[model samples]
Target: MSAESRPAIDGRIAELDDGQRRLLFDRRVGDAGEVADATRALLALVRSEGDDALFDFARRFDGVELDALEVPREKWGEALESLDSEVIDALTRAARNIETFHRAQLPSDVEVEVEPGVTLGRVFVPLEAVGVYAPGGRAAYPSSVLMGVVPARAAGVKEIVVCSPPGPDGMPSPVVLAAAAIGGATRLFAVGGAGAIGALAFGTGSIPRCAAVVGPGNRWVLEAKQQVAGEVIIDSPAGPSEVLVVAEEGCAQPAWLAAELIAQAEHDPDAAVAFVTTSPSLLEAVRRELRIGVAATPRREVVAEALSTRGALLLAADHDEMMTFAEAYAGEHVVLCTRDPRADRAGMRTPGTVFLGGASSVAFGDYMTGANHVLPTAGTARSFSGLSALDFLRSYTWQELTAEGAAGMAGPVATLAEAEGLPGHATAARLRGSKAGEETS
Candidate 1:
């Protein structure tokens, strides 16, 4: 296909109808019919059969037979030692960067005296255990390991268990194991897909139940997390990788801009990559560059398909109109490629991490930039945040009341409860007040 004739729709911002608006704003990846059905069946199998189900799924889906569900603790040491020195060094450096960045996100224990004799505050506590899922069927995700584990570790989680698909030999990837070790994972399991999410949500014979599950995964994994959301906390619906670039006339080079979009497109056929600008000539130049870049890239087919389907190079009337379009789109990664990106940042409604200026790339944020790459996708960035140290923690709100405080609150509590038709609540408040009166007497 020629560059201009590709699937992207080029038009003015004012031309977008309700259908087109929904097409750009909606998170529905085609229809989730098949994915939901498959995910439900897999989750049921894992929940009912436990380790037996895990083994079966491993054999059926991953094409590996597992004698054991978990990789032993001693195996972690061996895996760490077996990794190449350079790989280990890179992971170590990355781990330090991740840890340092996340440590700052740890919340301080809060205490407040709201009123006389009444103390109310929130106490942050780490989850007892957490599960980190690193996708491994198509490719190894050592970066995912660090992104999930390091944040939980920094949050002071006592136990962090990692679940990844096993290879043909029924062992987790050595590089993944090395990252887990470096990131402070307490345990590792050779389980993946929806089954692994179910195993984490509902405890198996070997895989310990986790309080929360945090990581990025495919549709099946994300669906499984959604199915079992009430059973355990999840970071977000992190399904596919997406990036949107807002470039001005002389903001970025066309070749570099095309490369950035292509990099996002190479992630998956379903992944979305979009570019918005006021300059039609720049968009044309980018399309020309994409024609050459896609042909030379190894994952050209994936990039081409992605660009055709979910990708766009939209033309807006001006920067304000472009911002309005971007706010509606609410992409996973938003890049600002402008002469002064910060100047345009005045009223931008950010859905995910923002890459400022032409030099900033999403790839840098994905790797060793000390920022978590597990961000919200499919317009959920409008409501959800990327995974961080806070995801592995639960806040407990505590209130301590003295006799005077109890007496002071009783009248209002009783009045409100009576107004709300809860006589029992009113009685309970009155009883507390009566006890306080008796104690004082």
Candidate 2:
């Protein structure tokens, strides 16, 4: 499709039942059989080809091939030394902010008295080892490295591992290495794509199988996580990034309107950005801002493609209708840069994270806002939460009953077991109760 001819949705907001609404706005990728077939091929290539397959595919797909499967440990120092000092300073500052926010997410020890002489409590402990996938071929999001690692460290994860694809230079980006060091990653692996995920899940020659893996990646990376998930835990398998901006006339500025849409669309060609506005003037102003602002961005092609393919400008009767659509749409990031996020938080039931007011952009939350960027996409946020310290830890419940307690409950247990026709279960419960009573007497 030509750029100008890319479908742009503009229509009156109408109330429809669940079935009708779904047909109109379902962003499910399974609906596109071609996309699914392509993904299947991507998965097949990696599983059959292994690291060699990954290298060839990366060259063909990302236009880069790497020689080293691992970044030399000494590169950590060189990466730091090579960085533009100002960028390092910014990353350092962002790391501190991210650390502070995630630290608060650290679970506190809880002990409670559920019953007399029964101490019921819970303990929070981090996983022994974790793998964080950092995207390397496209661009170095040093911020993403910090985003995944800081929380794992704050949660007291013992062994933190970093993995990413190599750069054009056939080495992992110096920025990624530097960020991993700053973020507290204990080890680094040069391998990326599905092979990296497999190595993390199964443990290859040099690397060990990680207990859980977390971070964002392309479709192949996402599929790899899903493939090996049973062997190891994984964060949500993400899809194309999306944003829904609910704007009101009073708060709507030209810059805010254009920036919010372009920000999400620039991430991927298939990504979507929608502006649901109630004001006609605000809509026109948004168009003007997009025309000017998009021209200035380095990633204008990506932004343009995203806006044209999946973009929308839905005219609503009022703010309530705008918010209602947003809830039903379930954006990965909802920029409620309007007035009060809390006032309408009840209206927003599905956003991964709410960036309220103009002070905080979607970028802020992704980089240093302490909120996890590994959020559910494609309306999955309705049931999933963004990644947090909890993602790095596991919780379990254990119970210990007193001998007297066991004896007192034995008749009920035996009765239920007998009702279920499990004679062995009933006998075990009865015998235990009898033994307890005899000992007590």
Candidate 3:
């Protein structure tokens, strides 16, 4: 497991069948038995013992004992005051950008008339409360606070709560608190792990029950969310970061592409990164740059592990094949490093977010680009979109019909209902009509 000794995979996409291609492209976070068992136990403890279990697990797992479960309101003001002015300014700017971007995502109410005198529409309502989790084990993600809480606040969520593991000093990171304050979180908790997830799902003595939980974390946190999905809504199974790039040989710089892959790889050891291209020479060039880049990366060990385990370079027959493979891969982040990026972008069907050139780095979208970094990972992008203001809002639909509208369609409606073996439904529809056969007798 040395960085210099790490392996990089090369393959031909046409040589593989559907199953093999899917296996190579799969990004589902694999579940380990031990981790699952540990997560279940922690969830049970949080469910049964409430605040007592939160304190116990904080001691056992995070190695910090809690004087209290929640951070006081005064701590937020203290954090804002103590933080460096530059960091605060950056977060404030990021918050403003996030709010502006997500505000544009607000769903407009819809109303339509399907038939004469019949109207139908949908309306949006914000959830009462949502829990946002910012990771604390390997790094402090103040950016996560901005991504999660800003959208909820924009959607007009009444209560926004935040939870992060306590550092060795027995408090959440002051930087995280500053971001939370900037992002408009109503409450903060110095809690972490599956315990924090469970506390949000099932209310603890101190933690309020949330209508939804949204954030990114490690395997244990993801599993806890899965277990409690029915009790509370989860944004998505956003476990680890990943990226895939489809590049044309002449259009992209090998070094820039290699740096993009390494950037995502450094997020976690389980992250997936891949490249599909028509040029064999470009593939080799990128690989060579990766070797040089990993040497200088601060998180070299982490990037090395990710690239060795989950990274690949696939040779596509042509540009079309490259796009086909990328669409099938459904990476969380897809970079189109092609000469005609706008044209190629239209053909890409699945991805949490699409970055259009060597100049537009994925790192830009992760922090200050105003686009959300809380993307759907592990191929879930095929079905789930990245988190936006809409995730915090629920739509309730309504229908209205005049008696004339109901009567005009009674015969067809009853016939369909009777054909479906629901005679009672047929009777209900017919009862609104004044025509012959409308009477039950």
Candidate 4:
């Protein structure tokens, strides 16, 4: 299909026609029953068979016969030594920025007195172990390694485990190893897909079980994560990569807007991209620029498929309509190419990450911007958040009360407990109240 023939919705999003609404909002990431069943079987096999299951799956799925599952600690140093100086420098610098950013996210314990002699507070505790899964099927995401590991390390996680699908040589990409080392992963495993998640969730003899598993991957990885959710904490279910570019006339160059859309579209065939604007001329110019940009890209087929299917060109009636639609869409990446991007961002509510101005490219955020790239997708930005140091930490609240505070709370507590028909709870509160009153008297 031609670029002009791609999906387009015009008018106020609130008053969209049935077909237009469906086009704009019906992009649900439905679960494939077959995929779920396969993932369940894979997880069961990994749980029942352990290392043998990993080897079998490695050969069956990854097409590599692995002699061992865990990549040796020594190989990380060797990988760094073998890599080009430029690649090493880039990974090292990116790791540094990522650590610096997440270190700032480390939360402090909060305490406050709600009333006289009554204190309540929450303390943050880091998980002891975490699993970072770097996808190696479609591409080597060394950046994902940093995104997952650096945050956990900064949050004070002691055992940061890394897992990735083995390459043709039966090991993860050397760049991944180097990133793991730079990010301070304590262990590395050459495994991937549902099986890798299973190993991390269930803990085989070779790969230690983790308290949480994170990083983005294909559908199999997502399905596996969902199945093992209660066993270990998983990040938000990642859907196809997506971005929404909200622009105004003359605010951003048409080529720059088109490039942003194409950059997100190139991620996968199912990835979604949309350009929303109030200016008809700007929309047309972006359509034209997309035609040129899509033709020039090496990933032309993937970009074209994405743009033709899930991509959209939405023309809103006004700035209010544009921003309303943007908030409703709640896209994973929202780029505001408006006159005042900051003001526009301040009014918005549900964007995984908002890139301000034409100069703030999503590509920069994906790599060296120090902001984590692992973000909620499939409209999940409405409630979910991007992966961060906070995800690796659990918080618990504590309460301390003086005798007077206990006596003050007891009457209300006992009354509520009696109203709820829990006589035992009422008696417990009354007994505490009596003891505290007597002590204070």
Query: Backbone collision count in every prediction?
Result: 0, 0, 0, 0
> Could you arrange the candidates by TM-score from highest to lowest?
1, 4, 3, 2
- Candidate 2, residues 51-89, lDDT tens digits: the string is 566567657655666665666778987999999999788
Kindly list the per-residue Cα lDDT of model 1 for residues 303-403, writing each as its tens digit: 88888777777888887888887887788888889777887665666567888988888888887889899999999988899999999989989998877
lDDT of 4 by residue, 351-383 (tens): 999999999999999988899999888787888
Q: List pairs with backbone clashes in candidate 2.
A: none
TM-scores of all predicted structures: 0.93, 0.89, 0.92, 0.93
The C-alpha lDDT values of all candidates are 0.86, 0.75, 0.87, 0.88
Model 1 ranges with Cα > 4 A deviation: 1-7, 16-20, 431-441
Q: Give the per-residue lDDT of model 3 (tens digit) for 164-219.
A: 99999788899998888899999999999899999998989999999999899888
By TM-score, who's the top model here? 1
Candidate 3 accuracy as TM-score: 0.92
Best by lDDT: 4
What's model 1's overall lDDT? 0.86
| Stretches of candidate 3 exceeding 4 Å from the true structure | 1-5, 11-23, 420-424, 435-441
